[model samples]
Target: MTMLRRNLMHAKRYPSMTFSVVVMPVILLLIFNFVLGGAMQAGVGGDDSKYINYLTPGMLLLLPAYMTAAIAVLVSTDVTKGIVNRFRTMAISQSAILTGHVMGTLIQAVLALGAMLGVAALCGFRPEATPIEWVAAIGLMLLIVFALGWLSVAFGLAAPNPESASNMPFPIIMMPFLGSGLVPTDTMPVGLRQFAEYQPFTPFTETVRGLLMGSEIGASGIISLAWCAVIALVGYLWAKSLFRKQSR
Candidate 1:
């Protein structure tokens, strides 16, 4: 708890990190929904005004990716500043350091997601989910944030500096664009379509879309959970290994 408070307080002291995490997605939401929404809707056979409904789910996925960069940078900053070494001298559990970063990122991700959803609502995004579906959607999103938070921690611990850490997760932020987030995969060329359909973000976006819009979830919910589990496991193991090496 002490470590967690320290992480959160550090974020509070540096508001720009939190601001970027929240604002980037919202800015993209506005640009996509207003500037390119008509062309995108035409391509996808959707109403221009209704593009927000389609875009918002994918935007939700971006929140975790954005938060990942912030967490990574923050983690790398701690390492570079010798804060982690200082903590190592203390009597606290070693795992608390990473856990604090993961939990802090998760909390910030959730709040940023909520703010984006509110912005989506203002932009004419109306979900057809029932109360139960809302709960399920929230749960799924939390799982995504949790999984990605650990991944960010690993990225942070692996990078030698904050600048590299920030750059490492750029591919993650771009995954949504390559997937079915902006438009249907069917609209893409053969090779691109195949990649878009098979990527993790596609199912993640699809599952959320299904839950919010009352569409068929089919196997996407299960696939999404499986992906989250794999990512979280890999991230946990990698982070543990890296931290141990650093401790020596």
Candidate 2:
């Protein structure tokens, strides 16, 4: 609890980070919902509903987006101030500090995600899920985002600067749009379609959308969980190593 509080303070120290994390998603949502409505219907791209549905699931994955921004700020500022190195000599539990920061980012990510939902509501968008479906959706969001938070921490702590940390999620973030997050895999060429079907975000987006739609789990949820688990495990190890080395 104490560590969580401290991590919250870390975010509070940089309000701009919080604002930024939510802004891009908002813009993307707006662009898709309004500006691109005609193009989406022309089949020049794909179904906007399918795209939004996929994005909705990916938005659950977006907790990582917020975490990446916040972590960049936190790690960069601490390193710049030399507090990280000083703290290495303190009694603080090594993993606790890093994990605590991750937890806080998870919380902020949840809030930002809720804000995204609010935007969805304002835009007259609605998912036809039931109560249990809603509960499952929220739970899924928490788990995926929490896992992705570790990835954010790893990148933020390991990167050369906050700017780099912020850019780290860019590739992953763009994956959703370019792959299955906003369009059907079958909509693309055979090669790209195959790649999209197999990519990490494809499963993640599909599973969450399926769950929200009360459809069968199939393999999407399983695959998404596996990807999250692996990323979290690797990210934890790397972040811990960097924290020990840099903070030392």
Candidate 3:
């Protein structure tokens, strides 16, 4: 709890940084809903407003990706400043440090996602989900964030400096673009469509969209869960290993 409070306080101290996490996704939501919605709508066979329904889930998935840099930068800054070292000298639980970071990232993700959902509601986006489905969707999103948040911490620890750490997670931002986030995978060329269908982000995005829109999740739900589990395990181990090496 102490570590978590400390991390949250650090985030509060830099409002602008966290504010960008909320703003960027909202801006992109507006642009895609207004400017690019028509062209994108063609693939989904719906009007712009209806398209917003499809797009909102994708944007929600993209939110954490965009915020990955901030998490990486924050962790790397702490490492660079020798804060991790100082903490090691204390009697505090070492795992609390990483857990605090993960919790902080999840909170930021929820805020950013909520902001985007609010804008989406204003823009005529509505899902057919029941209360249970809505809860499941939120859980799924947090699971994804939890997995990726750990990876971002690992990236931050791996980078030579904070600036490079911030850029190291760039591929996550592009994961949506390469998946079915923007358009139907069937609309893509065979190769790209194959890639889109098989990628980790697509299954998760599709699962969220399915849950929210009352569509079939089928195998995508299982795949998404599996992906999240694998990522969270790997990232936790990787981040812990890095921290241990730093301590030594």
Which candidate number would show the highest TM-score if scored against the true structure? 1
Q: What TM-scores do the predictions have?
A: 0.98, 0.87, 0.97
Model 2 root mean square deviation, Cα atoms: 2.7
Instruction: Go through the candidates in order and give each one's C-alpha lDDT.
Output: 0.90, 0.71, 0.88
Tens-place lDDT per residue, model 2, 88-163, is: 7788776776777778877887788788888876765567788887787677667767777777777778778777
Q: Give me the overall lDDT of model 2.
A: 0.71
Report the number of the highest-lDDT candidate: 1
Q: Number of clashes in every candidate structure? A: 0, 0, 0
Q: Which rank order by lDDT, best down to worst?
A: 1, 3, 2
lDDT of 3 by residue, 33-74 (tens): 899999889998956669888888888888878778888998
Candidate 1, residues 1-248: lDDT per residue as tens digits? 99889988998998998998899889999999999998899766856778889899999988887888998998899999998999999998999999999888777877887899999999999999999999988888888888888898899999989999999999988998999889989999999999999889999999999999998889999999999999999999999999999999
Q: How many times do residue backbones clash in model 1?
A: 0
How far is 65's C-alpha from truth in model 1 (Å)? 1.0
Model 3, global lDDT: 0.88
Q: Please list all clashing residue pairs in model 3, or write none if there are none.
A: none
Off by over 4 Å in 2: 42-55
